[model samples]
Target chain A: MIPVITAFDRSPDGGKGLARDTRVRWALEEAGQSCDVRPVSFASLRQPAHLALNPFGQIPTYEEDDLVLFETGAIVLHIAERHNGLLPVDAAARARAIAWMFAALNTVEPPILERQTAVLLESDKPWTAERLRSIDQRIDVRLGQLSARLGDDEWLDGGFSAGDLMMVSVLLRLGSSGLLDKHPGLAAYLARGEARPAYRRAFEAQRTFNTRPGPSE
Target chain B: MIPVITAFDRSPDGGKGLARDTRVRWALEEAGQSCDVRPVSFASLRQPAHLALNPFGQIPTYEEDDLVLFETGAIVLHIAERHNGLLPVDAAARARAIAWMFAALNTVEPPILERQTAVLLESDKPWTAERLRSIDQRIDVRLGQLSARLGDDEWLDGGFSAGDLMMVSVLLRLGSSGLLDKHPGLAAYLARGEARPAYRRAFEAQRTFNTRPGPSE
Candidate 1:
């Protein structure tokens, strides 16, 4: 059965492919899975229906038949585990791949998100600039560790897996921050992920939908 | 084959069970799996050997024969998938359980971690008090959402799964923060997790190790 996933009715990014839905879309495209999209406005996100689907009330919730799953990482992982392309067949290799997913969401992304919080939410605070510097330094430490691990290697492990997908998506958030410019290999790595045919399709789909005119009465 | 997991030689918590290893220990105990522990000092975690096992240089690395995995969420998940107790047998139920794991680490923990950053890393700054209030409010929003979803339920979903294991572990960090006291339901929920026999055993083991004297010559 085809899955249905919820996304922003009008993305805050205006179709930069930065929204979480793009990650789910990319995963489905990689898995050769065709899924339906349901647009949810910011106001409706807090409504009872969205809350039932996702307690966090965030976009990119996946519904397949009787199952409803939120958290983009989990949704992408679900598709990866069920399908072949996103994860390796080997047991050990598969666990390693999943490790990267957690690393992305937990270790790597936290500092990045902090930077965003500082910019978007705390920009009015007097200490915002100093806080941003600290956050950036923390991010740099993670990126350095990651760059070391990924040095001269194409993928994190044996081949491209869900690990790389999540990592690339997380790193893409830094595209505007210019941190990626400091690490040539990581920059190239992100580029490679964007170059994937599946990624292109996912990007275009979210972009088209996000940039479209508001719903008609 | 028995698995071996790595942890801090001396946890910053000094036996409080705040170290990431407790989560892995809890999962192993829950699964009735006996795994060896290899403690790594802070100085050694960044060294080549530990870095090879975990590129991020964090503790709680799981090594079983040829497979080496890190990230507490991934480690608990690996243990859960291999053993019968931590995940539901049904596919959809299993997916939902995994989503909670992501939610715990990604959504719930970030704000908590941010609060920690403010208290531990930036307390000396001039803006600490004002900044902490903002962080606390962000955490409150998440706690409110989680409490609403967990009202009168034993677990996040149908029954206790790895999701609860992870969510409880994440909440444990907030025990000293006083924020948990504001939400009675979540406080009780966390109490339930701590009350588990498996959790108690894991906590005791980590405490024993963390409080032990210097490594044997």
Candidate 2:
């Protein structure tokens, strides 16, 4: 049976597929799976029903027949583990791939989110510029390390796996910030991830969801 | 052969077991695995040898013969997957447990880390107090949601798993800030986690390592 996942009624990213749901979508698409989407408004997200599925009241909560889960990393890992495409078959390689998944979400994404917080929440603060600078510096350090690691490699490990999918998703947040351009290799890397047919479909699906006209429009 | 994991030469936590290594160590103890700890100084962490092991040049890197891994979440998950104690035998329960692990690291810990950044990096800023207040409120939102979810529960789910282990570890970061106290249920929950024999062993091991006299001392 197909699983269902929650997404934002209106993504803050507008038409861009930067929402967490897009990660799960990309994973599903990569795995040749079809699923259902349930969109929840900001208010409905905090409601008891949605909270039952996701205690955090966040989007992209996955619900199968008997099992329900939240956290995009976990959901993606679940899909990848159950299916065949997103993880390597080798025991050690798979562990390394999973490690990169955690690195993408836990290590790499933190400072990027901090930069977003600085830009979105603290722009009016006097320290905004300095905060952005510091956040960017931190991001650059990771990018430099990542670039060194990725040097001429197609994927983080062997071939494209969930690790690349997650790293590319996290790196995409830096697109508008113009940080990707600073490292041409990473820019090319992100481009490769986006070029995947699965990613393209996922991006388009989220775009349609975001751009659909409503009474407010 | 015993595995080797890196730790801070002189932990900033001063043996209180707040560093990320403690999480891995706790997982190892829970699994009844004997491993070697290699302490890496801050300067040495960025050196070529360490960078080769961990591209991000951070501590708590796991080296098991042919495999090298980083990220505390990944390391802990690795130990749990290899050992029987930290994960349930049922697949669905395991999935749920892993979701909590991701939720702890990605969702819950981000704001806590933000608070840490504010305290350590931006404490002298003119807006420090107000910024800290904002950060704390964000943390409180997650804690409130977590408290509601964890009401009257001994562990996060059916039993003690890696999920609870990670959640308790992440919540420990908020100890000095007194944020966990606001949610008495969650605080009690954390106390129960600390009461585990595995946690005690891991904490004592890290404490001994951290408190060991330096050459200069």
Which candidate's lDDT is highest? 2
The TM-score between candidate 2 and the true structure equals 0.98
What residue runs in model 1 are displaced by over 4 Å at the alpha carbon?
B215-217
Chain A only TM-scores, each candidate in turn: 0.98, 0.97
Q: What tier of docking accuracy does candidate 1 attain?
A: high
> What is the TM-score of each predicted model, taking all chains together?
0.98, 0.98
| RMSD list, candidates in order | 1.3, 1.3
Which pairs of residues collide in model 1?
none
For model 1, how does the per-residue alpha-carbon lDDT over B1-217 read when each residue is reduced to its tens digit?
7999998888887899998999999999999999899989888988999999888899999989988899999999999999989999999999999999999999999999998888899989999998899899989999999999999998889889999999999999997789988899999999999999999999999999888886631
* Tens-digit lDDT track of model 2 for A51-170: 999999998999999999999999999999999999999999999999999999998999999999889898999878877888899999999999999999999999999999999999
Cα error, candidate 2, residue B186 (Å): 0.9
Best model number under DockQ: 1
- Model 2 complex DockQ against the native: 0.88
Docking class of 2: high
| CA lDDT of every candidate | 0.92, 0.93
